[model samples]
Target: MSKHVAYTQFIDFEEDVKIRARDQARVVALREKKGWLFRLMLGLVLIGPGVLVMIADNDAGGVITYAQTGAAYGIGFFIPALLLSGFIAYVVQEMTVRLGAVTHRGHAEMIWGRYGAFWGWFSLVDLVLANILTLITEFIGVTLGLGVFGVPHAVSAAAAIAVDVVVLLVLRYYAWERVSLWIALGNLVFIPLALMAHPHWSTVVAAFSTWRIQGGFTPAFLFIVLANFGTTIAPWMLFFQQSAVVDKGLTVHDIHHGRMDTAIGTVAMVAVAVALVILTGSLVHGMPGASNLDIQQILRVLGQRLGPIGEDLFALGLVEAGMIAAIALTASTSWAMGEAFQWPKSINMPARRAWRFYLPGLLSAVIAAAVVLIPHAPLGFLNLTVQVVASIFMPAAMLFLLLLLNDATIMGEYKNRKWQNIAAFSIVGLLVALNGVYGLSVVMPHLF
Candidate 1:
């Protein structure tokens, strides 16, 4: 009886080993079968949130700011400055990735849970309000762009709203991200427009070497620089990217991928900004009375210089910029409200289940659209107000971000390094001073 038992045990152990070997072989085979196409698909799936935030950062406001920079300063100092801002943007946003992956919490939720109601509501209100105002600017860009092709403002606003609704309602989180990424990719149209302008390559190369401002550091020049800073790193971006990273289901293992995604986006965003500057700089820079040209006038100048193709492409870029930003800003608002209130807070939730989460964003968009359609609205003042509000709210947002990143109870092994903290603090200090200056300039026009 003992011998029979021993033989049976040996047989069972052999069977277990064989089973283990088979499973291991299967896993290896599956891994080996993952070809370049498979890897590519996987990468695409992992790359949406960061890319969306970066592209959305290059919104209508950003495009206008870059165009204005090129038109006014002619790419002397702003190009390198934009490149540096891109790096700063990356540094700041990378914290969002780490925070999201490690904590699986949105920025608003972190502020609320870690701090208290006051700071939480403070951040939430600031984000939602900024989002609404930014949405208005986006619609304005959309209507203006479409108006170039004879589409009325009402029709354009309606179309933009419908598109936003369909994208949010019909798609789950992954699908929504993928769709938004494709729309964001449309922003690359500015590149060819830059080429069409036929910029002098030698001069473009020499600008960086010289690194001199065309008009020196005048008050107007400083204002544009601050505008560039404001547009590049907004409160909405922090909310949007963190919530997006969480919603996208990224884990700590995926942090490397997230960083790659953000870096790629940074390059793409800077490239587009530089291209816009080059396009407008080549055509509109130093033109008679062109220093203060609005976006419409900039497009008109493009049409005049490069003809209809140039005009149409620039218009298309504006439309894409506005559409992409609206998608991100609306979603950012929804996510922040959901996180703050502890509602069903995912784009993956079906419309019926997540209506509460979606309502705030939808309402904000609708209100913004309605505002845009009103006859003879003070759009210039409204745009300035957006910038000013963002400036006022920026320091608070950065403070919360820094606090959360340094919270050892939350971040564990992934907390901010000393260098990162130093860099971030330096950035915050500079932004605070700049925002103060900008605020004074806006409120008291003669201060600068």
Candidate 2:
């Protein structure tokens, strides 16, 4: 039995190396295929991890953040700011692409192997806890969206769980990536919903010119700004993208495609976020008693303003956003755990072979779904707490990411340039400061 187990491990390792080589060889073949149109098609096929990560970043919780931003502040400040945030997200996430391609290791593995166990465990625990909490929010979004269609919360959650399980268990890595990209593309539903709102095009355009706040730096305004920033990039994003790149078998030669994938995703993410803000901003902004409207209330107002179809479409977008993010977050947790513990990890593995690798993510989704089924769960508070915890941990995650990216031995030619480090550290500084203020506000409400 021991010898059999060793044989299995040996087979898995050999298969892993072959898979990586195949990925690199495929890229070489595509490059040698010649025609621009064929290369374009090949590029599209290669687009997966980066696109998935960015869109998933604009999750259910993120939708709510954008909604609140628009409802409170109109289109002024946030629209263009979100676009800039997309670029910032790209800049940071781009490093993960290079790191994954060069090392062929997940972010967690790099930290554990290079930086030592203490930091490794710290990153792993932070990612797992955040993923769990964020998964709960995804379930909440699913339930809330489906609730509008008269589905019971339990049914909605159960269905979501089933879908997640099927996607993870039945699909290989390539199929899973393609399926996820298709689902993520559905996030465009928000664009039509925004159009349905009949927002003032001029007002939306004017926002970029002014880039000014309507209310001028109130505590409430600061809070929403931080929320937007926090949602745009998170610690899980770093783990998910790097692991995904590795799992997808990306190599340094394919880094350009990966960067393009991430760029496209960043645009999609920001566009969807801006659309949600516009949908709420145009319809509900400055309406009587609109200041404190939650997502349910916002949906209610949407129904009143744009009829049942508009409301239903918005709800559908919410459901898609939640499910897509749930998929990515679940996979992130699984990959992180597998990398940290040196377990076999691949979406391509058969269920029997990779059950241990897949179990953590599946169990997390089930648990989160079960929690959402409970009567009167404090979902709103839980969602806010997820964002706060993400902000608190963002600095540490970025620290490791920077450290890894800067390591000349590991990254070789892919290591961070001086400008990359400067920009990354600057972003980290801002996040740390924002987190400090946010923490203070939570701990001492009167101070803000």
Candidate 3:
């Protein structure tokens, strides 16, 4: 292999080399073992980037969006729609795994290397802005979720920052991945919380066949559809998972495992989303202005209907959603910046040695947390707006991703197959069409 390709495909840091070497050795040993349980153990070790990206995709903004969808429309449409979105997310993210594993470079780095600086910087700026907006909503989740336990916003925000910094700085890449996965397990809290709502099983099952939007083709319905799309398959996910695969030292050999990891995460992501919608739909649907109700109001209604325990579990889930996402977003920001600017970047590097790599992510999180503390800020709108912004930006991001994946010079044998390209373009087409429809709706309000 050429030096350029080799460098693109592997970490250069001594610390990263040592750690990943140890990990690779372990994988080899596991592969030599002869049993299904050993295969499962091997799979566990290989399952970080995909799972983290998907679960983190269900961030605080996502929690709010799902809750709002449930409250406004019930489980009639979005439950099945959530499953579809999960498939979309998996298809997109699986490509990233292949790209990262084949090239050993983050998405930003690949864009910069293959494309030009103009496009590269454009993609970078777009990602940074979207990540900042999305990160702020995450802090909104952290503060609001903890507010249920009587924790003040400032305190919750500060504590969240502390936890994020420690996790990013103190842990090496392997440790960070393990810890993040453990925290991500908290996302399942929404499942039991949904159960607390005691939704009718028949109604939930019937939604698959019904698949009807509650309010028909209204502007609000369109907005929610876009918001759900944004939350499910945002641009940051493409960057984060690919960078994570690189940082975690996945190679073309690990593509199968990486794909499996992404698939599992996709299922978890959709299941939790369905649960959130069900929880709110069973309790809050049909309330006055349900579509317009914010997170706090939604929580209050949940409290009223399911009692305080339901409220607390939902709140705890929100906090977990925010905290885990903050970790991923912070790391995503830091990794993208490092890749774009050629700064030294790797989670394996200790803070004392790689503060430049870590500072941007930390700073972004602090700024987002500060914004969440603004008294009477329209956080609910801000949260939904962030997801919409992501939806608007996704097509551009997807375009770049498609171009990279189709380039045989880079992807070689792993170049996107014909079916994959079709699926990707279809997703982009749907996003563009919806955006245009939304624009038409705004311009000529009487048409619908």
Top TM-score hit: 3
How does each model score on lDDT? 0.85, 0.88, 0.91
**Tens-place lDDT digits, model 2, residues 1-448:** 6633542343356778664565557667788898998799779778999899999988999988888889988898899989888888999999999999999889998888777789989999988988989999899999999999999988999899998999999998888988999999889999999999999999999998888988666667777877788899899999999999999888888899999999999989989999998999999999987768889999999999999999999888889999999999999999998888878888887889878899999998988888888888898888877887787788899999999898898889899999999999998998988877777777887885
Q: Give the TM-score of candidate 2.
A: 0.94
Score every model by TM-score: 0.90, 0.94, 0.96
| Residue 82 of model 3, lDDT score | 89
Query: Could you say which candidate leads in lDDT?
Result: 3
Weakest lDDT window of 10 consecutive positions for candidate 1: 7-16
Clash pairs detected, candidate 1: none
Q: Which clashing pairs does model 3 show?
A: none
Better of 1 and 3 by lDDT: 3
Q: What is the Cα-based lDDT of residue 402 in candidate 2?
A: 94
Model 1 Cα lDDT, one tens digit per residue, 1-448: 6633532332233332342353234334444566897566556657877889999989887888789889988978888888888988899899999999898779998888778789998888888888988899889889999999999999999999999999998987767988999999999999999998899988889888999977655668767777788788889999999999877767787788789899889999999999999988899999997788888899898999999988988888888999999999999999999888777788877889779999999999999999999999987567655765676677789899998889898888999999999999988998888877766776887765
Output the lDDT of residue 403, model 1. 89
Clashing pairs in 2: none
